[model samples]
Target: MSSEIRQLEPKQLWNKFADLNAVPRPSKKEERVIKFMKDFGVGLGLETIEDEVGNVIIKKPATLGMEDRKTIVMQSHLDMVHQKNNDTVFDFDTQGIDMYVDGDWVRANGTTLGADNGLGVATIMAILECTDIVHPAIEALFTIDEETGMTGAMGLKGGLLNGEILLNLDTEEDDEIGVGCAGGIDVTAIRSYDQEETPESKIGYKIVVKGLQGGHSGMQIHEGLGNANKIMNRLLFDGFENFGLRISEIDGGSLRNAVPRESNAIVAIDAIQEEAFILEINDLANDIKTEYKTMEPDMVIEVSETETPDQIMDLGVQEGLTRAIYAALNGVYRMSADIPNLVETSNNIARVIVKDGHVKIGCLTRSSVETSKWDLANMLRATFELTGCEVEFGGDYPGWKPNMDSDILKVMVPLYKNLNNGETPHVAACHAGLECGILGTNYPEMDMISFGPNIKGAHSPDERAQISSAQKYWTYVLEILKNIPKK
Candidate 1:
């Protein structure tokens, strides 16, 4: 965290953001942040409750002359996706984010900025602290583990809050008002295999793929960005088929929600094919870079000599695994029929690991349509199952269906236009997984809408927040709070 960011306009929100970012809040490991929020609420002398599942709820009575307005629920998840560049040396669990000002944006040094929901969390904190900001009764709900599985939202029990309207401040685009979002499920395939001794004449080499602009798997799926796992498998498949390559180890990608940016593998090939192998692999690597020249200018692939391993995977299993990976899907599966240019279904083959005689392939599949989601999940299951792996599905959550006539949508559309010099906001649905959908499972009657500042390259080290947009978004938040409909 930097003092420079705390000096940004709207110090109320930026200051809170700096304070919050100073504490480590990685997804599924939010114990420190949970306690921080509870302490903040307790310090303010507000009624705060920590739910059984680790969600924090702070209640504030209506401001003067606004008691008749409906109590509004302001929600933002507490945890953030943890991602860093391969060479960055920092512990996410132990240290605060190292952020700096980069012209119009605030970015971290080779690590994710946690702007996806941290900014939203800061907005509520500012409101809860400000005395002059007008508003109705407030229910500030901070859920944890949104990036991994939305476990906090899923575990929320019904009848916890009495608010009639919900405002989710997790949308990434400042000019867009989110009315719905895609649902998601986690798909993992696992198996163990036999290891065999390497041949006497085999030579070892390390293949590295990195420098790709990885991003949010769901929101950026249609952008055609390079997936390192997919690219690595392509190169491996080529080596095995043409040069008699044998795989000893592979490790790629990190979180299931982030597009894989790098992959590294150890492989062995017959000694006689050394010259031809180097030439072909370099040529193939160049071909991949050229193919993604426009979308991934920074993409890089490297191959180097390394010590040969004593053992490698059995030939039969290696063949099956490579083929299975090639057959699996990595990007968009279907486009929305109702909304123009909206992605209806997609998959991100996020993690691939082959080590210690065990193989694990992790994926996150998302879709707005229920049937289409399963259609893609089963398709992936079949592909891995064919390779003698057992597949499991978990973290199932439903999509937030668009409510074109939502009361909050009607209120914010014109408010946004007025704030932006008559520029009407883009009212639409998104492909990202938002907690609004999971929260709806327990609160179906609450009308909801999501909007936030301009945050780009989320779930990756390139993640940053635009300074100007945060100011604009903060103004809109104040207006919406003051204009809540009467109960």
Candidate 2:
């Protein structure tokens, strides 16, 4: 563990976070971390149970004289989105996150720090181990595979938990309590293509776009960051029209929930036109850089020579694929009429891939309104269908509706203001998906609210957690627990 993290305030929470940094818990591959969590609970002599889908539930009895209080469930996901810089060599399946403190924040080396829910999990661990804190009966729920899909939350059976109140420790901002979140569904389009041999007179060049600050698709969608997949399509469309470029392969982005940061493509052009094509690409790159100068100053665009491939995508397939992607909606489409500055509906053109016989495009759409969610899905389906591509939707999860009169919110909001010296925490709804939605379906009577320490750039390699905010959040949650209403 790094000495910087070791020296952070609230030794218990930071220490547990350090321990998590030594475990690899990427989404859908959490066996090692699961064992670690189960053992940690057992070592503490708490009642621990692992559900069929791998959600861990650890129960601790209430403090003396507090046994009559309503049970509170503290929930956070056990998995993290494993994203890394292209130059980084770490493997998510075998390697632990290499984290270190960066001034006032803790970050990883060229990879995601997993602080999104790790900090929450660690805080729960700290609370379970501490004998000094006063709290009612606690049930710590560690869910799995939240990054890719809400598999754990979806599979969670009703009546599995007895808690009447659930505190979801997954929201990023320390100063905001998330009362609700947008539901989401993934859209995928695929089109089979026939390959044609590259013309003998053509030379191959690789075009790449990098250095964009790709972030959480939902949380950062309104930030105006560039999406690499969208940018790549623009460049490809231009090259196709001007230079007669024939694409051999194209790939970009990785996760459906993260904004794409980098993209690249290999294309063939007549050797005589190569010089002009290169110059045009450079000019286009500069134009893009200028357009996004404020949000992505470090954005890089490069076109370089590469080995010629034997075959390229058929002209018709190439044209259709490029056009479809270029026309796809890729950012905020609508903002809430009721909530100021809140995005009510949005789309992320998350990923694109070209393989042996087909090209596939992946997209994710989110909306707080059920009607808008399906509206956006149908729009995406129509866009792809026009290009003769087959489209499908999956991983749909319902949104959590806000309850201003929520029982837990009534207690926590006032408690937060008191703890923060009269500064009230912002109670808002998120555009991103949270497990609270699915959990609520199983436990309709359970009152829930989501909040956490300040974490930035979630679902991307730039993710980090604020050190001071972690300490402050820990103190706030403890006070809330101490004041839980008696049943």
Candidate 3:
């Protein structure tokens, strides 16, 4: 290998990470990254197959002594969730992620680090390139659009893989091995009413809610992060009680799975009470910030001056929309009564927007149990119906059921324990969705286990990967590959 190849020891993973980050590979826009991998595979003379949907599977022949060992498929998603702050100007489609080093941590500049799956991608790249590592016949399966739709995994066929055992390299924690994950469904509610002309004397002020730390709805839902959309609605609800205000426009939040960071409402306030309204709004924001100081320290409301704004929605529509959002779910709804630390059912009021004469609210509901998920979905439907709004639901995916008796776990438990000096790995199920559950339904008999290095702030601009954990996970993965027994 040339010096430019960048050796991928955990300490040196940053270099390889830098190389990958230099390429733009947002979800469904991975032609360059796909071609890069293909070229690398061809250069190494490895048997590589690039599927129609940009999913790539590279086959590496087993070492001389381990040729008889069984094959194990190493799986990871190719694409990443593209998100950035409102003030960040970088474009995901054209710009490569700008990354920087922070001691043992590597993070992107004002954008998601892509370390959630980038580490997995780089690990496979190094594994296939290394000549010294011991391994059986290995298949590095890189699927596409996992963050948004999981389209690549959904297109998989039964016989596509030659391996009966799969090792998913997408888990976030280094010390824990994920055995299962919650399933999710995306639901949208839309309310539309005729616009009304602004009253001649009604004053218009832009009520803005800003500076909240919106995070991944799944991972950070339990963390008590403030949803800006929910906060904005609260202000509107309170303002209506004091002074009659017409909601001209209401918009906030982003990503179906991320807590809304900012919200803005353009409302028509009574001109006589405008000064008091501004003071009250600021006071309310301050009080909310103090209340959620630990969760959202920077939370604030800015009542701004604006030119004569066009009408957004009529009073009746505004009232119905406000009521619907108030009744809508925002935080932890139900906890697992059975499991000690499990979140059985929950929903995030992820995104709310006013566009094209419609008020659209995007909600994400998750649960380990199918019944609970459906119940939450039904609740959302009922809420929309109460407002006489049309509701739509789709993008449902299955949850991975934990297999305490998973066949692969039975074999690998002792191996992992022995490798780590008898310190057993933590076994747990995640609240977030994993490909394992979807793949489980696709391949009923396939045995799967997920493990990865420590990654923080996944699905957010502040995401970073721990350097030392990468080395540990790489070494452990190699051990598993070398010890795969014959089927």
Candidate 4:
């Protein structure tokens, strides 16, 4: 363990998080982490099972006389979003995360800290390793590919878990308890284009927009953060309409669940119009900076000369793609009428790629209301279809409806108040997707609630987890387990 994390209180939890940091476990590529987890469980002499879909379940019988208590399942995903600064040279597949203590929080050096779920996983590991804490029969369920897709949760068979209560350790806020979460689906649009030779009289330039604080698309959609793909398209569309620019290639964003932080494009323009086009781009960049100055203080736009390309996108295809992307919905569409400050429906234009003879655009839509979810999907489909592109939707997951009368909530609420001297914890639903929803489909009878230590800037390089909250959260979990109602 690193000296920095070794000094934090709750050494058990931080030590486990440090160990996880030394292993590369990006979403959809968790083979190493899976083996590490299995080894950790077996080393503790616990019964461990790895399902066909890569989900790991470690069962620890109740301590002493607590066997009659209802079985409680503690759940967290085993993967982290792989993101880094454009200049950072780390590879998620080969390099472990570099973690450090920043004042009251733990963060990475120019990369994601993976604390969104790492802290939760560490907490579970700590509980399993400690024999001194009193608890009911316990099952630690770790799912895979949660950031990119809920494949493990979706493929988990019914009756795989014998638990009657599920405690999801994936929520971000320390003081809030998540009882429900939005369902989500991904939309992809693809269009084929012909290549046209670049005119000899045209000059090539690379235009870039970067430094935006990209975060979890669903969690930070309402924060007014600039979307790099949208911002880049706006500039491209303006250049296409006013300066007669032709695009050779464009790429932005990497993951569908993360807001795009940076985008760059190679475009050509008639040499005669180059000076005026540069001026116009500068003007637009300044206006955008002024508009988002508060939210994106470090946002940068750069236009630099580049070597000419052999071919460019067909004029018609370039125009159509620019128009479609500019018109696509990319932010919160509605807010919940019942839950104050909860997003009801939203969409994120997550990524764009211009490849060989084609361009693909990806989006993610989330909503707590099932009908509203599909309504947004149709809206995106119609928007893209109007631009003569083929659109498809899949990877849909159901929402976990909130149960105010839930047995776990009934026990946790009062217990939390007593633990904190009558400070009532906030109960709410998250806009982001949680594995609890998919797990609920397989085990409809399980009562579920989610809570975690404070984490900020999830899915981004700036991600960090609060130090003090981890200790309090660990204590809370232990107390909750001790108070579980007997069967």
lDDT of 3: 0.81
lDDT of 1 by residue, 249-330 (tens): 9999999999999999999999999999999999999999999999999998999999998889999999999999999999
Question: Candidate 2 deviates by what RMSD?
Answer: 0.9
Lowest summed lDDT window (length 10), candidate 1: 1-10
lDDT for 283 (candidate 4): 97
For model 1, the superposed segments whose C-alpha errors exceed 4 Å read: none
| Model 3 lDDT per residue over 372-453, tens place | 9999999988997888788998878888888898776776677778878998988888778778888777688878898889
**Best candidate per lDDT, number?**
1
**Candidate 2 C-alpha lDDT tens digits along 1-487:** 4567878889999889888878989988999989999999999999999999999999999999899999999999999998899899999998888888888888999999999889999999999999999999999999999989999999999988999999999999999999999999999998899999898999999999999889999999988989999999999999989999999998999899999999989889999998899899889988989999999988999889999988899998888888889888999989999888999999999999986878899999999998999998999999999988999999999999999998888998888888889998999999999999989898999999999999999988899999899889999888989888889
Residue 238 error, candidate 2, Å: 0.2
In model 3, state the lDDT of residue 465. Answer: 80
Q: Is candidate 1 or candidate 3 better by lDDT?
A: 1
- Which lDDT tens digits does candidate 4 get at residues 357-436? 88899999999999999998999899888878999998899888999999899999998899889999999999999999
Candidates in order, TM-scores: namely 0.99, 0.99, 0.94, 0.99
Total residue pair clashes for candidate 4: 0
